[model samples]
Target: MSSYRIIGLFALLGGLTACERPTPPLAAGQEPAYDLTSYLQEQTARLQQEQPPVLKSVITKGQPTETLQLEELDWEKELAIFQEVDLSRPALRDFYREERHTLPNGSTVSIFTKDAEAAAPVDRLQLTVSPLQKLERLEAVVLEENLLFYSKRNISLTAEPGSGNLNGYRVEGVQKLIFGDSLRYRVDANL
Candidate 1:
C-alpha cells in the first residue's frame, strides 16, 4: 500500500515536469530578428538593375463599346505609378504573396495576389520584367465581388478606372460605371 502511494506521487511529479516551459525572455538591447524586409529589398534591387520594360501595347476588351488600346505609352508617366508602390510596409507585405517566373525572352514576370480575406478592389497584379529585371509588361484586374461598392451602385470591371502603387508597379486603370437607370457615366480609377 505505501509503495503504491509513492508511485502515484512520482507519476504526478513527472507529469508536472513534462509540461511546456515558457521561453526565456530576451535580454536588454536584444531584439528578435526577422529579415523578410531585407530579402524583398534585395530581390527588388536585382530586378531593377536591368533595363526597365517598355509597354508595347495595352488592350481593354469588353464593356460599353469602348475598346481602348494604347500602342505608344509614355514609360515615365505610365510607370510612375509602379515606382511609388511600397512593399516594405508591414501591412502591404502581409497582404500579398509574390511569385516570380523567368520567361524564354530572358525576362522575368512577378505576380502578386492579394490574400483571400484581405484583398479588396484589386485582386490580381502582375509585372513582366526584362532579363535584367526591367519593367516589361504590367496588368491588373479587379474581381467583380470587389466592384459592387454601394447598394445602388453596380460597377463593371471593364468599365472602371483604378490606380495604385502595386508593390513596385504603379498602375492607372480607367473604366466606365453605371449608376442605376438613366444614370450612366464613365468612372475612372477606383484604387
Candidate 2:
C-alpha cells in the first residue's frame, strides 16, 4: 500500500479505538473534593440537630436466610456523574420502606417495615420506593469495615461468599451498613 493509504488506515483504527465522554467541567473556582466520609459525617450531624427523628441508632437481628432470596438487581448507563439534586428531574412524590423476598420454592413475600432493622442474613431488606417523579437512583452502604456506594438500579447483591474480593457484596465481616435514604442495618452471618 502507498504511504498515504497506510497512514489513513492507521488513523481509522485509532479513531475506532478511542472512547470519548462529554463530562462537564468542574466549577470554575472550586477544586475536586474526595473526602466523602467527612462530608457524610457533617450531614449526619446536621440531621441529628435539625431533624433528630429522621436519624436513628439501630441494631437489628436477621431472622433466617434459609428461605429468603438475597439478590440485587442492577441497571446503569455510562453517563457523567450527577447527584439526586443535580439538574431537573421528577420530584419524588411518595416514598415508603418495605422488605420483599422470594423463597426457594418460588413464593414471594412483602412486608412494610416501619424501620429497617440491622438484622440477620435471612432478610434482604429493601426500600419500597415510589418516587413521585422519575429520576436517576442511587444506593450507599456504610459497612463496619468500609463504606461503599453504587448507583441504583445497577448495583446487584449476591450471597455472602465464604470469602471473596470486593468484586461483589460479601456478608462476612460486615456488621453495619447504610443503604438508601439513611436506612441503616446489620447483616448476621448464621442465617
Candidate 3:
C-alpha cells in the first residue's frame, strides 16, 4: 500500500477511537442554555469517525438531518368530523417506501416502510408521519385537493424553486433540517 493510504487509514482509526466526547460542564447555579447546534456538530463527527473508512457510504447514514421536527396539529380528532371520509377510510394513508435495512440478525433486509399522512376532519392541518426507517420525500394533500409543506429535509439532491427545486436533505436530530430554504421548490426525481 502507498504511504498516503496507510496514513489515511491510521488517521481514520484515530478519529474513530477518540470520539467519546465528555459532556460539557454546566455553570454553577446557572442553568446552561440548550445548544442544538453544538450537539449536532458533535454527533456528525462521531458518526463519521465510527464508520469504517471504505467506499464512503456502505454504512447507513441513518435519517436525514436527525433533526427535521414535525409540526403538530390537533388533526385526528378533527379528521373524525369529516363527513365524506369513511371511518374505514384510514384518515392516514400508508404508501410503500422501499429501503434496505440492517436487521438485528446480521442481515440486510430490503423492505417497504409505511408512509402515512393524516389530518383532522375539521381543523384541517395535515401531518405526515413516516417510519423512521426508510422515510423519504414526505408530502401531503388534503381531500386530494389542498397541498401544503410543513417541513422537509435532505438537500444533497437538487432543489429548484420557481426555477430550481430542493435536492438532497439532511437532518441532525429531532430538532432541525440541516438545509432550510423555504422560498419555493421543484425537485429532480432522478436521484
Worst 10 residues of 3 by lDDT: 121-130
Off by over 4 Å in 2: 1-9, 16-19, 35-185, 188-191
Clashes of 2: 14
**Which candidate leads in TM-score?**
1
lDDT (CA) for every model shown?
0.44, 0.28, 0.30
Local accuracy of candidate 2 as per-residue lDDT tens digits, 73-147: 111210111121111111111111334444464433333222244331112222211122111112232222235
Q: Which regions of candidate 3 deviate over 4 angstroms?
A: 1-32, 52-148, 151-191
What is candidate 3's lDDT per residue for 60-161, written digit by digit as tens?
234232222223323222122222211112222223233444445343333323445533322122111123322122222222223432332222212222
> What lDDT is obtained when candidate 2 is compared to the true structure?
0.28
Candidates by lDDT, descending order: 1, 3, 2
Provide the clashing-pair count of each candidate structure: 14, 14, 37
Alpha-carbon shift of residue 147 in model 1 (angstroms)? 10
Residue-level error in angstroms, candidate 1, position 107: 1.0
TM match of model 3 to true structure: 0.16
